[model samples]
Target: MKKILLSFFLLTFFQNVVAQTNLYENPNFDELAKTHKIIAIVPFKTQVQLRPKQMKDMSAEQLNRVEKSEGESIQTAMYSWFLKRKKRGDLQNLEIQDPRTTTAMLKKQTIDYNNIMDFTPQELAKILEVDAVISGEFETNKPMSEGASVALGVLFGFFGSTNSATINMSVHNATDGILLWNYNKKVSGSIGSNTEDLINVLMRKSSRRLAYTKNSKDKD
Candidate 1:
């Protein structure tokens, strides 16, 4: 009976993991880059599947409390790393809006955190007046590795290795009001895997890509 229950539980867990959608990412980033200069890093918007270790710390009753506790801090840290990258690269005429300020502004409109896009920072920029908007969701899913390459010690406690959370990024230009770029990245932990390395790496990558190109200025 115990084995049956365990199998049932694991099956239910995998079912939900399979249901996680790949189609959620919008391919049209270029179109989103119109009319804003503030790239606002908001909270993790995904309900990511958990590795065994995370599940150990939280009972079903404590599930909601545990995930919410980490989302805000992680988002802030990731945004900070992004700012550092921009400064390092000497990207001029670029402005990053404070994550906290954006969050507060959204709250004023009675918009829930998940509905951030509907408010569309570009429109807000015209009100507050900014050049561009950058925003994305960082979701962490702890995926375990398969087979005997794994250690027995973890099986006694955990299931296997994890893929960590992939960071999904989107850039929007406030002037034209269109999305510029979007992609999923298995990051090192500016936000997920409980480390800082990934965030810095992501920031650097984004900074280079987001740099105001000479060609773009030529058009202006």
Candidate 2:
């Protein structure tokens, strides 16, 4: 019985690892990156697939609130990750706008985060006064406790429980509002997985291809 259970667990784990998907990455990203002096990481559109128990317990309003919060959390995480990387010299002359500033500006404009998707990318960039924008959608198959995830990551680097999430990140030119680069990936979480870990994992895989970091490899 023990052997059977172990085998099954291993199979499930491996499946999770192998099941991660990369949907697309724009090829002309480098050209776009070079022109960017500042970029905004906007709140993502979040779709949480709640468990049956959660559906029964949570009201629609509660769910909507949580979803909105998750979008901001993800936006902040992505910004911090890029800031750290840029500070570490991985990204040269790249600036990620402060989330607070973005929020304030948007609020003054009467733009609600929930209605962000309705705006054109060009319009958003102009409002934010950025060279480009990084925006995307986040989808998750499980309920995640954001605080618990961060605590676990800080205490134990890798031994944490995980859920599955997918992200579609795109960069748009502030001038033309055209998508300059895009990347999509499906990732799994572990006990130690936090927002930072997730963003780091995704960025490491995609950043080399990102125009802003094209010279990162040659820097050392």
Candidate 3:
């Protein structure tokens, strides 16, 4: 019985790892990032996929609001991660624009959650007066900020419930509008998963390959 249970656990863990893996880095990332002293992190485009029962009480507008809120939550989380790294001297002379400033600038330009995707990354960078822009998309079945209860399957049933989230993060250069790096991953959230924890896990996995990391630049 013990062996059978351990095997099942290992199999489930392996599946989770395989499901949450993807990364890309432009060949010329070093060159493109050379002049990028500052970068702005825009609100991530977010989508919440709720089951029928979950959506029964929510209107379309309410759903949209939830998505917008989630997007901003992710944006703030990402900024916090960068700020922490910068304070730790893990970043390579990089300046992360505050999300409040970024949002204010976008609003001044008549841009909002509904239409922010209409503009190109380069355009956003120019408007925000930054050398590069960090943007991404997040999709989940539940609100991350609220730490909703979710269940994975029997595999997780043994432990507890879990939520699933798919995240895509990318960096774009302002000069030529070229993608410098991209990361996509699917994560299984344990109970009490929130934006900050999600961002911490996501960033920790990608920090080693991030072009702006001090260690990455040192390799050049």
Better by lDDT, candidate 3 or 2: 3
On lDDT, the leading prediction is 3
lDDT of 2 at 171: 85
Off by over 4 Å in 1: 1-38, 51-62, 117-129, 142-163, 187-195, 203-206, 212-220
Return the TM-score for each candidate structure: 0.56, 0.80, 0.82
lDDT of 2 by residue, 135-161 (tens): 999887543447533433343344336
Task: Compose the digit string of candidate 1's lDDT tens values, residues 1-220.
Answer: 9999989865754343321212222344433433334556555554446657656855664444334434554566666665654566543445666877867776777665546557675675554345655456665554211221132224345533334566666655565666555545654322223325345444433444444431222110
TM-score of model number 3: 0.82
How do all the candidates rank in terms of TM-score, highest first?
A: 3, 2, 1
lDDT of 3 by residue, 1-220 (tens): 9999989875765455424669999998977777788999999999888777557866777778778888998998889888877886766677999999999999999998899999999999999999999999999875776422322221122222466788999999998899999999887745235788777656665778887873732220
Looking at model 1, report the run of 10 residues with the lowest lDDT sum. Answer: 143-152
Off by over 4 Å in 3: 1-19, 146-161, 214-220
TM-score result, candidate 1: 0.56
